[model samples]
Target: MSVRRLRNLLLVLIATVTLILYGCSDEDPTSTSSAGFAGLGQDVDGFQDAGSNSSLTFPADHSAHPDYRIEWWYLTANLEDESGEPLGLQWTLFRQALMAPSKRPEPTPWAADQLWMAHMALSQGEQHQVAERFGRSHSQAQLNTTQNSQAGVVANPFHAWLDDWQLKANDEADNRDFDNLTLTAYSGEGDTRFGYSLTLTAEGPLVLHGNGGFSQKAANGQGSMYYSQPFWQIEGDVTLNGETKTVSGRGWLDREWSSQLLDARQSGWDWFSIHLEDGHKLMAFRLRGGGDDTDQAQGADYRSGTWITPEGQATSLANSDITLTPQATSAVAGRDVPTRWRLEVPSAGLDMTIEAPHANRWMTTSVPYWEGEVVVTDHASGEPLGEGYLEMTGY
Candidate 1:
């Protein structure tokens, strides 16, 4: 095999083993040995923990946190073609540290200290296409540019990539780093080709979740540093099934990192990102099985969220401030996955029904899950309220 091909195979093997052992909340929820859902609630003895006192800085905080065990750059878009048909797409790059910062191996071409995986999916109606790739890198190695590593992120230029699949700053100017960005990734070929080349421009300031970026995930205080760019105007071309179309719509990009992100008893989570018609945005999630003493015995769930106004104002929503109930389920991939839900926020005077128009949007990657675009409507009148995305894991 060619040297490059051989290296790629080796990296894939390493990444596969790392993901299997370390566990990813959305990737491997079936792991029996994991401390929490997909090992996110596992103990972090040597890794860095996300604390409430730590402050988040721009450009610098945008880069990788090698001291943490897990991190991800995730983006989801709700788009439409000129004909008005809707399409949803997702691009995520996940990083897993093979060892703690103190235990990293010496920087060498053959030694790797980190495992990287990238997942991209495109869904339209019943047609859902997905692809995954893996790569490896030495955290200690100098990654001044994209060519220095197979997969890595640079904070200054705001580039996160794995192979040709990349999300980077559209402008080289420092001030425009995260505000104006570009995303490009494609997989398959011939009749099965699929991917997107899109420009994402931020419409609002970045919103921090929970206690100023310290997003609490459970009652036990386990959590991660979470923030998002939820107001994005996206425009570009998307190629699916070997046919390309001009598309434009709204997008949301999420950034999170942590060593332990869940409580030991939590088994899974249902997450939502919504963009209302009135220019409001909402981010909510429920971690199943991590409640308090009485609640834990009854298998209760912990919920948290952020309510955002169009002008970039944010309000943190606590467990008692919101309610999410799975109103219906669909048999997908041999699993009973919730495809319809009732979301309520009394403070915002919102009572809405969220449903996935398409139930076949199951990602068939190494670690499978259900993710798709959802439509929101007023529960009382059934009037269309907005649209967004839903992600359900550990079904």
Candidate 2:
């Protein structure tokens, strides 16, 4: 690499690390008291907040929202190799504004107003390989053919990238911009290398959460604009430990953004996205605290979800409509993380036990969390129901 390019990359890394380690969350990464999990509930005095009336526009919405304090393009896949062994992977690009719109620094070649972080993980059996990258960019930076920013996103053709890791529209597809996409990301070298190059074709329409697209995260009405493309037919090659295998299965892509996504009293959350064998899909979450009822000691947990049909129809599940209970825990990274859960949606005639086949799916990044594939079964008969991914944070 040229000297100037190397220097620029170093500067971006330094800026991202400094912001995440010092300014973003609590001084103590482990503390959820002052700032909600990962500082998501921290003050948003100047940033734009997500509201019930906010409208979601396609193509445009697929790109970054610089006005929002935090946003991410997150995709998770559950696949099987040629031999049918289950494998799972996740690729997420997160963007956090360094300053509110009015407070942004002047746009310059070396100035950045956004800190970008991307995380990639591949897990199978007991093996879990993870990688993370950081970059910086100015929200107002112009796009040109000569050179692209270290990390950024574009709407028309739908491209989200950081360095060489990218998730973008598939030029060969005949479907809508986001309906057909391609993802490529790799890390490490030689024997340690792992990642995937996959094509994702949407089998169903995008499903929005909460009212329209306003997903309420707390009883105080704080929330984010959330939606998902949960029916993706994924096919491609996955490499692990330098060995490549043909894989094909389903994937889920989630889009959410907000300036203040949680209530100050909210600590962490347990989120699940499931695809049943019977053609139904479910998305549910439980925010540990931050609710209206103060009579309870630790405050009531805020719960919400979406019950999606095969045809793309959706039914919103309110707090009273869902139940998420931690059935079992495991020692992971010095913390007791819930690896088994009972998720019930009586309204949808669903009572299933979700358990992680592996408990070591910890992302040891700047801000760590537990994320991995899960098996779903009949709560009473133990009959196989389906498969999905589980993410537990602030444990």
Candidate 3:
């Protein structure tokens, strides 16, 4: 979301002011550049952009893309307990580097040019529990020596970690297909306690988004390498408010990396991952602002996604292929946020209205956002179609 822009802005702004008064120090390499939303839109120096010709390799792609300015390992789940009450869960690992790969600072003990942040949440009924943590590590040594640092990610067998929180391979198999994984995370204490211990197994193939995984975020060609595994069958245990219970459901995992994640004027994004009852999966997202003048004049936004069949075959979608209209809003975190939407993809024969049964999925972090489970239904008849997750950032 806006996590990268916020972190980069705050750090760079503070460092710039400090340098102006006390001069630049070795510990403070940050300058007051446009590292915020506007900075991200500008062409970056040193790092690599997501090129159309770039290809993705299996186990390596699942690990890390530190050469890029920002990357994340994100997961969201739609679950139900024994009584059939609905529940939602989310866990994300975000890594932002101060410098590109070639400019990595010397791996001196405690020296670093990278920052890591993690967010975890669980919601049901009117209850929502969330937690966030931040850490720092050297790009080179951080991955090698994981004793001190509280966060990191590895390739072989596939594992992403932050302190005790982890989403790792479950079995010892070395095929490296990345089909099975174990996700463990928790936060808070006493009556506010909440967490999950779940296992995820792929029921379909990995889905490459946009053109062979190069997901364009702007009409001007700025974008990221994006992909997803959206057919996960999950089963596990969860603790809510000091009570533990068995839970089973489905999940989706998204991996994306880029030097420029969005355009300068783009405010934010609305992303959706829907699991239909008929076994189909729909992944769609809209980037607000900064599209071409023609589309902008008509109030169009940068949109793209993939429609996945039960077997994982994916058809790439373009901005003209879909339409997302917010139909309702709710007061969350003191902001009126869209919690209901009408989604349609005419060529794909999809016309559905989706709404969040629980509208308070606000993640009050350093970069605040709203994300939770939602239900989809027929646009005309209002009949239930499926359930999935929704994420809205930057208001």
Candidate 4:
């Protein structure tokens, strides 16, 4: 099928999935938290606007948040095949708080107020494969534990998991490194199937974003708590396109959670996470909004990123230094999407062209958008710079 046609198909799939999701929840909207905080946003109670917060804590903070409305475990990797061909892969799990803990459906054995969604995709030049899944769990059931849910993080043994996807260490010794860790993710059916089982070593310490994991998303202080382990040492096998090839590449893991993720005026965002040639990693994102038109007195385009050096230090990329311009638009998931973009970070002395390996990597979930692996090249020199992932939403 053509790219545009495939995009349309994906869109229909996503829309159908969303309608099914709405039908699954027959709860009375009035019985929930408050007005305006409809849908999954209702799970949070008394949510104040985002503001400068104190530094975050480890182990405890890295775990799940039942009170919050939404959270996610997002991972993306830029890999190479046995023949040295570049490939991009992404695995993400999102949790949406459905109802407040105070309002339980019943003491019934099977009840739930938590919604879970997962997305997995593979990207190669002009070709893409994407899949999405959704499930619901009750706080009163075995699905969610008071100490920890089915999805959680524990420091001692160093384990993080949700459903079938997981990353855990083999040894529990304090001195033992997370290097001997196993990561598994699988989905799809028959000829359209894809999955991965890999081992990851911590090549470096975890890097925090925006002054130690408090990423500011909007001028009004609505943003997500975010962090990344961008320096993973990864090697293993991934089954794709009817073949399982042993692959090795640097992987990046990002963890983010928040009650109010976006501002009312914001529509979506364009985000990039890249590993450069000279031992550096860059994460940049643009938030779409009605900026200058607002009384907040800030511009509509908001962008920020973390540039990490091989030596394990991070520098912030400000708005003025970065640029994202759409080169062309392609239909994805029934929407016209800018699948190609020109990205430049002047302060880092980098100018690159960002293009998807394929244009059909759109997740058909409760909330859908275009997200996939992308190729980066030096704009001036026309040299292949590196591989990374790009996500564009609400367009």
Listed per candidate, the RMSD to the true structure in angstroms reads 2.5, 2.5, 6.3, 7.3
Q: Summarize candidate 3's per-residue lDDT along 281-375 as a digit string, tens digits.
A: 99999887656776456324788889999888999988889999999999988999999999999978999999999888899876678899999
- The local distance difference test score of each candidate is 0.88, 0.88, 0.81, 0.68
How badly does each model clash, as a count of residue pairs? 0, 0, 1, 4
In angstroms, the error of model 4 at 125 is 4.5
Ranking by lDDT: 2, 1, 3, 4
What is the per-residue lDDT of model 4 for residues 1-395, given as tens digits with 9 covering 90 to 100? 89656644654554456445532344432232221112332223654223357466665555556566667778788888899987777877776656666665874433556666677776666667777655555544432333244344444455656667776765643444344567788777776678888877778777888866778775655567788888887789988877788888988888887777655445568888888878888899987752334543543667788888988798877666678788888887678988778888888887888877578878665566778877788877779888788888665
Pairing residues by index, what is the TM-score of model 1?
0.95
lDDT by residue for model 1 over 1-395, one digit each (tens)? 89989987887788667657655544333233457766777888899999898679998888888889899999999999989999999999998888888888888778888888899999988899999998888886435654478888988678898889999888754576889999999999898999999999898999999998999987778899999999999999999988999999999999999999887767779999999999999999999866655544554789999999999899999988899999999999999999999999999999999999999999897778889999999999999999999998877
How do all models score by TM-score?
0.95, 0.94, 0.89, 0.80
Q: Model 4, stretches more than 4 Å misplaced?
A: 1-50, 104-108, 125-127, 138-156, 171-180, 290-299
Ordered list by TM-score, greatest first: 1, 2, 3, 4
Clashing pairs in 3: 34-39
Question: What would the per-residue lDDT of candidate 2 be over residues 166-191, giving only the tens digit for each residue?
Answer: 99889997754898899999999999
Q: After superposition, how far is residue 75 of candidate 4 from its true place, in Å?
A: 0.6
